[model samples]
Target: MTWQSHLIVMPIVLPLVTAAVLLLFDERNRRLKMAINVISVVLQIAIAIELMIMAIEKAPEPMVYLIGDWPAPFGIVLVLDRLAALMLVLTSVLGLASLSFALANWYKASPNFHTIFQLLLMGLNGAFLTGDLFNLFVFFEVMLAASYGLALHGSGVARVKAGMHYIVINLVASSLFLIGVSLIYGVTGTLNMADLAQRIPDVAAQDRMLLETGAAILGIAFLIKAGMWPLNFWLTPTYSAAAAPVAAIFAVMTKVGIYVLLRLSPLMFGISSGASYGFGNHWLYFGGMVTLTFGLIGVVASQAMGRLASYSILVSSGTLLAAIGSGNTAMTAAALFYMVSSTLTIAAFFLLIELVERGQDAAANVLAVTMEAYGDEEDEEEEEEVGTLLPATLAVLGLCFAICAILLIGLPPFSGFIAKFVILSAILNGNHIAPNTAAGIDPSSWVLVGLILLSGLSALIAMTRTGIRTFWASLEGNVPRVLVREIVPVGALLLVCLSLTFAAGPVMRYMEATAHYLHTPEQYIQSVINTPRVGGKTENGK
Candidate 1:
């Protein structure tokens, strides 16, 4: 009931209101719409940061806001914990960067671009904050609907083709989401997440299998969104085909699935859930390893930068899923750090691809691949000028490209390297195993470690090859006419990654606390169920 509790809802409401206001303006008033959109997103970032600080200070206990002044297990609620707050801030930052980039040119692609963009943010913030299973489904649909428009924003042959596939795949996922929700609701008689967590352990034996069946179906739906191996065939092409800014924001869409898994898996199926303990974990583990391996292959085989960036997203997702499946507190914390670092890097890479590809012929990639496959056959008369100075714009692009490569490859002196190192150390040290046990580390742990290292090496090769073709091989290529507006967003994203590198200690501490909190489901369930409604009335009216 405090004033600060009200801030939890603004992230969702502000964008919803802004999108409605945007609809009132004529398409010709693009500058006005863009200005409004930018201001709204900036306010969201401010609000998200404030919420994050509050969540940190509050630690362990979540801030719950009840809708309609109704108590838990009966009414809608928004829960803001350390993890949810972190996601809110991440989503807001990515939104601002992507929107800024779009304003430069891509916004002109459609009259409703700004409108759809705000809706997407609304859906993302809602999904992150909602405490009810049904509301989560609602938000998922909203996010997917908005993404459909954004994917086809430019409406080229490739974009449309990929957009259709994206639409179809998500539609199927949404259907599965609904069916799973219905099954769980029927078995448990509750749709509120906290309520379900409290009720899960008490479900009758006859209904245990049914409950898990529903949960498994639900997991499959989320895995599809997370771009897990076989379910992810549609991902690379669809992401590669999206408009630059749209694709940049879509980077976080996959994480939405990961976030839900991080929240629900522990809360509903942890050690406390008698027969259901550790359900679906092995699937996540093996699936993640395969996804990582497939992504590494894609990264090395990709001929286009867009596809390469898309594959890198799969790599990030696979790593997170595997770490989560391990169920190690230290590994989960490290994965959270890696999640933030990789998301920002991939988003920046998507935006940067637009700038780097500008003024280049479409056949350039093909030609570069061909030369590598066969020969360039350059004439001796066409002597290369080895000492020529690079243009300032090209130099800047090259530098940004190199930084992205380092981040993606998990090389030293960056957050990516720190995250990977923490994960590897956590696994190798057997932190998850009991101190008194004689058993060694799990073999699956070794497989995960190998996959992570090999993925990094593959990424290094792919990025280096792409960079040489983009910056060095095409010496005569025209320097792109980059705009300050466009370049600034990319710079801002990379700067945040660099900030993460320098501030790894504090960030890792926060993530560790979050992971610990997640492992303790009792605290979360108590906080949610015990939160009193307005006027100091309990759900039981005591």
Candidate 2:
């Protein structure tokens, strides 16, 4: 009833309402639609920031909103904890940036761009806020439905082909999602995440295998969404073919899978799940390693900046998966930090890629020919001040590109480096392991270390090569004609990542507190299940 109670649902409702209003207008009203879309997104960002502040100030008690004043387990509830609030903030900011980039002209590419865009945000926010498994599935479908439209927006052959693949794969994933939830509900008699957490330990011995089986199948669906290893082949192509703004917003899509795993893994299968404690940890660890390795290979082999950015998403996903699977509270906390940094950095890169590549191919070809013809004499050309102050347009693109490279490669004086350092330090210092568990660093942790370093190195090589070809080697090209709208979004995204570097202390503190709550889910479970019916009248009283 109070305004504060409404905060939990505003993120989902605002977008949904705005979207409905926009759909009333015809394609001829593009300006009106965009104006509405931009204002809605800006407001959502403000709301998300306030909710995050509330979550932090309130600590472990999540803000829960019951729809229609219904009781928990009987009606839908939206919960906003530290984790959910953090995700909401990320989603809102990404939506704002992507929409701004689209305003430069991508919105006109499709009649339904604004509609689908708002629906996508609604789904994303809903997925983060929902407190039950069934609603999670509903939100997944909503998000995927919008994504199908966005992926196919431009109507190019490549876009259509890639979108088709994306659709088919996700359709199958959705089916598995439903089947898995059905199995879990069939045995547990509950779909509420908190209720499931409470009941998992009490599952009959005969049904334990069935429960694990269902969870495994469910995880497969999540992993596919997260773009994990062998299942992720569709991601790079799809992302590479999408419109720039679509690709940019999609940087958070894979993170949705990571979010579910982080949320449910701890709440349902944490230290409380009896023999099922830490279930699927090994799968996550090994799968993440393979995914990270595959992503690094893809990055190195990618000739196009779009494909490289796509692979970077995979690397980001794998890093988080591995961190979560590590079962180390500190490591998970650091991964949370890294997730925000990587997602924002990659989103900026996606938008920048299109701008940087504009009118560049001709110059690249000419430079290549010049190099081949000059052969040994090319050293003289290379020695010329490659860093000579660039033109304004090129200068902005080059600076953004350089920052992306630094972030992706986990280089110094940036949030990316700080994040990676936190993870490595947690591992080396044995923050999560007992002395008896390992003499020094566990071999698994060592493998993680090697993978982290090697992947960063590979990413550095790939991004550096692309940057030189696109910016440095393309010096002969005309200055890219980037609009202020496009530049502002990309710059804002990069600045957010930069700000993370300065705010690392407070951010890490928040992450540590979040990780603490995750590993100890008693409060979360109790708070949700013990919640009274919203109205004074219970079913009997009514």
Candidate 3:
């Protein structure tokens, strides 16, 4: 109705509209399509920033919108809180970066690269904005559908094979998502997230089990999307096979899963007897810890650059899950902080990999592919500086390693440190819980201490290896120095991480606010439940 509402909706709508516009352009006009994509992304970024300001300056409660004037519970509800706004901002910026990354390779690769990329961004924004059960499901499908197309945009054998498996797996997961929602609705009699949050707590104990069953099913679906541990088989390779831009932004695909997990963790399954496995928080932490550990080992153990970056993404993801599972409010907060950090850093990493590959014709020189593309010599040799890379190239790589090392290892002077510190402290101090409750973890203080210490060691070892190979040791491969196209996105992400490191005070304050908003959904639920201006009628307003 007002500007704020309009702004909140624009992020989703702009991308959808942009995708259609992009599609209408002559596919042969690759530059035109990319221009449209960049324009759409930049506009979306502006809208996200505006929404963030509004979110901070306006009232504390989320900005709620009911589609078609339908009452809150009966109609679809969209919410914009610090958390959602934060996500939109992060994804929008990263989306733009990825767009640029992909642009370099898209000109010759596919006619519809620009169109598909916009659609992917559209789905992600919609997924973040939708506050209804079915809406969330729809957005997930929207994103995956576009992803299925973009996943194979290059149409190579490797891309097709990996993309197909990625599709089939997510397809099954999608079906499971719908089934879970169907069951949830069959029991709770509502699809609105805010409404369900209230209703699920009140269902008859017998019927509540049905809700629990549905929630479990839904959890599995999200974990599959999040690429959590065992179900992540389809992830690394799909990413590795994708072109640079696609790979960079594709990293955010799991954000959809983590977003749902974080959203529902607070809303759908708040502090209830239904809180099992630490309300999924315990699993998140332990799973994340293992993921990080394994990822570190994978990176150290792997030679392929693409595969190595893929492993890094996995490690980044595990860090978030571990933070969540730790069951410390502060730890969860840290996980949230890390979520943003990991995404940007990894996106930068992938983009840089692409640039380096393109410039040096690494695939041509090292992998034996032939290419004089980009006017760079295939066998050109560049002088190496000891204990440092080419100034520009090494700086970018250094930034990547620095951010990843600090964040993953939970080192100090960065948001990662702040986040990990908060989580570790929360884990060690032992928050109060019900007597003899499962929430009462075993030897948590010491166990968490050990894990944190172990994580630190692993992070050190992993970073040491990577730093030695990429920066310290003479780069075995003669990749060209960073290209201008590559510099913007990677540089943008690296700078943001560095900024986060210095602005810990403000960032932590924001994170704490976000955590409070998530933990206490009373305000959110009440905002929607008490809403009555929908469908020009008084309905579902208890």
Candidate 4:
């Protein structure tokens, strides 16, 4: 195998090794550990970028790396394609930003914070790259295990309470994952995704119902993780309660579920899969619409910025789910673009929330709400109006908050607007709905478009309300003592969102290609199953 081939596995191995090395150090040696953690993440980002370039330039087919030189359907494999590479780069970037923010002080919340963080990255990268369902379960557990620690890292009442819920919900999801995998294996006699895709079309009539039943159970498990409505009651509380940096990294964690759904739906249940074509799509579409509506309600109702940010995540997930369920190539591409834009925006917002709230009291939100709802009757003493210069730190925070609001609201001049525009356009122009035609747009498509627009407006209202309370209403409030480290990560994340705006053309092209590739899974299947083992020898010495 070439060196580029070897890079496919480095994302997983690098973090695994770094976490092990971190265990050797004493908790007192925090600076060293932090340095090591940052360096490792930087390397991960570099490697991920290189792999992305390789995926785009050198690889027209999915790059497969066999573990122990074992061939497909028999041994573990990592498959790197345009989509997987994009996810790797996204994970690494979020990791670096979150870790940088944590180093400022959050890392001190737990001695093993850095260690657990690396494991989380390893798990995320593995989940994206793995080519088998069983290993996907294994990686899901690893990611969730690390998240449990991160969620409860600071050991606060709220954090612990929410952490326990998070743990329980994920544990149940994991159980369903295993059960589904076992059913699939029993019916198909294969756990490898590529093999399963190849066999799904021919699944015997006797077992077709069983296969789909297992698939439905598996979809439920992923939907819970994706924070789909009804299944997502735990998401808001858990995410809102997590530490700022931890929550920031977690902005991408939910996407893992979305990614798997996107990967499997087309590969295993596309038009080629006789009886199973487009299975569960209606659920995804309608369920996503409900999730989006629920999230919009939460966004408007949220009293805390943390909860608002968490709800925004649901909004992003719901949009992606709906887009994927539509099964339109254009919509999927647009969704991918929105996914990247929204994740970065939300991550920055999560990190920014901590910084913004640093100077405010615990009851500040409640006080603001109470004052707004009722009347703050006080002695009427009119004082001469005086203009005070905004402190530099507060100014930066306010500006960052405004940018986040704009992005979240899908306002103009950012990638968020571009993403939403494309998505709306795609929905209007979808196969079922022809633009400027006698049929007009379908009712479902119209509902989706309206919901998306309403969600954006709702986000604007929520963010504007929160911003006024936090920054404008509290003019006399103490300026938050923001560190360069914390602020820099938030800035970096927003800067990335801006970069996406400037590079939207190229980025959209890549996403379109990825969506096309996903829609056509035959290439992926053949590549994974037909790739020769090392030394050009199979287990049977063929």
Candidate 2 — which residues are off by over 4 angstroms?
Answer: 362-389, 431-438, 537-542
Candidate with better lDDT, 3 vs 4: 4
Per-residue lDDT of candidate 1, residues 440-473 (tens digit) = 6677777888999999999999999999888988
TM-score of each: 0.97, 0.95, 0.87, 0.97
lDDT of all predictions: 0.91, 0.89, 0.74, 0.92
Candidate 3 segments exceeding 4 Å error: 272-286, 358-413, 430-445, 470-477, 534-542
- TM-score winner, 1 or 2: 1
Steric collisions counted per model:
0, 0, 11, 0
> For residues 137-226, what per-residue lDDT tens digits would candidate 4 score against the true structure?
989999999999999989789999999999999999998998899899999999999999999999999999999999999999999999
Task: Kindly give the stretch of ten consecutive residues in candidate 1 with the minimal lDDT sum.
Answer: 429-438
Give RMSD to native, each candidate: 1.8, 2.7, 5.8, 1.8
Off by over 4 Å in 4: 379-381, 432-438, 538-542
- Segments of candidate 1 deviating more than 4 angstroms: 378-381, 431-439, 536-542
Cα deviation at 352, candidate 1, in Å, is 0.3
Model 3 has an lDDT value of 0.74
State the lDDT at 147 in candidate 4.
93
Weakest lDDT window of 10 consecutive positions for candidate 4: 430-439
- Candidate 2 lDDT over residue span 36-66, tens digit each: 9999999999999999999988778776777
